[model samples]
Target: MNGLPMVVSEPGLPAKVTIHEVGPRDGLQNESGIVAAADKAEFVRRLADAGLTTIEVTSFVPPAWVPQLADAEEVFAAVRDDPAVSPALNLPVLVPNMRGLDRALGLGAQQVAVFASATETFAQRNLNRSLDAALEMFEPVVRHASEDGAWTRGYLSMCFGDPWEGPVDPAKVVDVGVRLLETGCWQLSLGDTIGVATPGQVGALIGAFERAGVGVDKLAVHFHDTYGQALANTLAALRLGVTTVDASAGGLGGCPYAKSATGNLATEDLVWMLTGLGIDTGVDLGRLVATSTWMADRLGRPSPSRTVRALAGASAGEKQ
Candidate 1:
């Protein structure tokens, strides 16, 4: 303790971590009731105001397939006109096929995402095809988007474990990740679809990617909190220099394939941990918690964030 400055010993983690909020797309997709277009726009606006830089605004799949997102075009239109959410930040839409991509491009989206699974069983259930066929189907979409200079993110679901297939091979994940990169996607998000990955497993999978010559900077992590391992696993990825993390506000998401699976890592929970560890997530914790509260109210449920619950309890006590 002699003579060393306190600031030198307690320096913050890195100054930047990109938070790709998937509340609007991933969160609402699995919801039973459809969220109104206006409500959805307001939700995104509130998140943006709370300092989320990159938001996954919507998906362009057909209405029949996902009735929850039937108002995709309307929601995109609303956000496009919103002064709070501007072009300075990004609003990446998930497009399942060329038609979805066309709709997204028409709405002036500068960024888009495509979805694929690492294992055959999940792929069949999700995309109704083999792994190779699903990847081949996105070729034209990726090619066109790249020509237009739009950034694309490819989601590789069940990178560590698949509910149907049990455990996923690390090399299989690498093959899909490489194919996506070769198709010109700027980033690939490896998902823990069932939320069963431990920190050690996360490190091993990330190490596999490193050995395959995949730059850590081009990777993102989407973790489910089913078993309460999301944040711990996230810390592991951060330690490996993977900066981007995908989270859903209000902890809203679950995999239909895994019955016991919980939501994506709560945005509020992740922000709290990052800020405490001196990591910069560019997200305001209090406002994010407020937004989650609002959504929980709308859905008639309590918030799932442990940090939010603790803060709320303290606030109530102070008020009393």
Candidate 2:
């Protein structure tokens, strides 16, 4: 079977797009078992090797909160060991609070992200605080990062739908998003936490942000394939001129806090679609497929990414 991705340029979508790879941190954090620091480092290295420049390596949340990333220090050190890693790589770590930010910055992390929830229910459940309280929590973190002159990103989860809240109000989501941007976030990634969003919902949310004066340039989309709407929603985001997309390599992870949140949109799948659209992601598809295949082997399971399975064949070891 042919593995080369066919190109077909579409109108509106940019000629080039930036992919934020979340497999290492967001992906692995949801695994039922803990992945060793060495393997996690290898995973980050392989992704960088595959030409994913923007990679979220690990989170600085307390180990008590996320045992999966208990070795955050070791993992960060191992990945940064390569002299060639930084100037060419964009490694961002998630910081849950002031302590998390302090730990990451202490290790010389140049880029950090703050995660928030659009809904009060999810905010309380995932963050153990109210929606307003969560933002109050991030204020200091973002401020400290700015003072330190490190790049900062803000992740707004449940932008589309929330498990406990049912369908979320697009306007409410807009308010939350604008608030996050006002908090000094360099970029805001809108998430479809439970994967219940369709392309229309995605477009409406983006339009809401646009109306609120949050241009597409400062926006990113993070989708999950739970309802198989990830690709469709991503296409909508691209058509609307939103360039940055968050995807997981080999469809590796979901929300550890949101139990219903399934795996993220796979990096391989996003790359294949972008390549077919004639959009430059600067990623080598074959190498990316191989990297996912290798990661799946180490994780002791088959990848859920169709592109990986199709390109790598039985080496993918995918289950139905």
Best by lDDT: 2
Q: What is each predicted model's overall lDDT from 0 to 1? A: 0.86, 0.92
TM-score of each: 0.94, 0.97
Candidate 2 per-residue C-alpha lDDT over 234-265 given as tens digits, one digit per residue, 9 for 90 to 100:
99999999999999999989998899999999
Q: Name the regions of candidate 2 deviating beyond 4 angstroms.
A: 84-86, 314-320
TM-score computed on alpha carbons, candidate 2: 0.97
